[model samples]
Target: MEKNKKVVILNILLVGTIILNLFIFTSRMRFFPWFIEDAWGYLGVFLTAPILIGIYFMLRHFHKQQLVTSTNKVIPLFVAATSLIIVFMPTTDFLNIVAIVINAASVFLAANFLFNQNGGKNNYGFSRLKNQS
Candidate 1:
């Protein structure tokens, strides 16, 4: 995907994940009187996390001008696999545990990727361009 398009997709995924988290939190905490409990609601919450991780890697790939390492790419696959397992067997608590572990590993890989690329510095900011001498 093109850089600009990938950036846009990443932003959308990020926003969606935030919204999903809010809904889940509110539903669990009974903070929102208008919160409707439904099967689709939980499905959306569960699916957004993996999608966000996948988009992060995709954007990273575009930013670096190279494909992410094979191991890194597998994070999304693991997320998807766990998601499928949960979908097939939503009542199984063990599947949720597996999914959590997979997501945690993906997060670790993403952090490592970012830190390595930026030499352990915060590279997610804007800076004024130097004036031509």
Candidate 2:
């Protein structure tokens, strides 16, 4: 597959996995009350493993393809950091909502960067900078 197309697909998969992680984390109590009541901490680890693995492999792929721009490199770090925070923090409704919003925003930023046509360039309001001599 073409590189751009592969990146797009990977981004899609990344976003989907993030959403799934959020859903499972937020609703684990309702969906698996027995498991949560018995092993809440382990549940966090179980839920987080896939996301961390996905981020690791995605970063590896980007690095292998020489697509590791500053912006793209930081995107996965932000995703992983926020995900870890969500997993390790004390679980409260407010905290969960806040974490979800932060995670979603980071994911949105990642998607924007991955899908940009200029290859993640930060123009800083100078749209014509690259074209200028």
Candidate 3:
């Protein structure tokens, strides 16, 4: 599959995991407003996180099509970010951290693909001199 398509699939799975975890965790929580109070707010916020994240990534993905690109540096950056996310996941009740890690991986792969295809684009922005003689 194409790198970008794979990245989108990863993102969908990641977000699905997050939303699923939120629902599951909240269902098990005995002290945090079962039917009313903050439960609704919490649910909204939880759902919002992945939705918003998805929107951002989707925007970035499409934007990349419009004179957008990537680099090898982005791969390392994603690796570092994913590592941090893994390190922090064990401490949290929600699995959003896992989502972040997956997102990082997708981005890294996309970046790697981008860099491999365009060494010059990696070193600098897209050429504005295509108009030059």
Model 2 C-alpha lDDT per residue in residues 1-133, reported as the tens digit of each score: 8776776766666666666555555553555543244325435545555665676577667767776455555555565666676667767767666766766776686677657735545767556546766
TM-score of 3: 0.27
Candidate with top lDDT is: 2
Error of 1 at 118 (Å): 5.3
Q: Tell me the lDDT of model 2 at 74.
A: 56
Tell me the lDDT of candidate 1: 0.50
| CA deviation > 4 Å runs, candidate 2 | 25-48, 117-133
Model 2 residue 18 CA deviation in Å? 1.7
For model 3, give the 10-residue run with minimal summed lDDT. Answer: 67-76
As a TM-score, model 1 comes out at 0.47
What residue runs in model 1 are displaced by over 4 Å at the alpha carbon?
Answer: 1-41, 45-67, 118-133
Q: Write the per-residue lDDT of candidate 3 for residues 55-116, one digit (tens) a residue.
A: 44653664576423443223333433443444344534355445444545555555444444
Query: What would the TM-scores of all predictions be?
Result: 0.47, 0.59, 0.27
Better of 2 and 3 by TM-score: 2
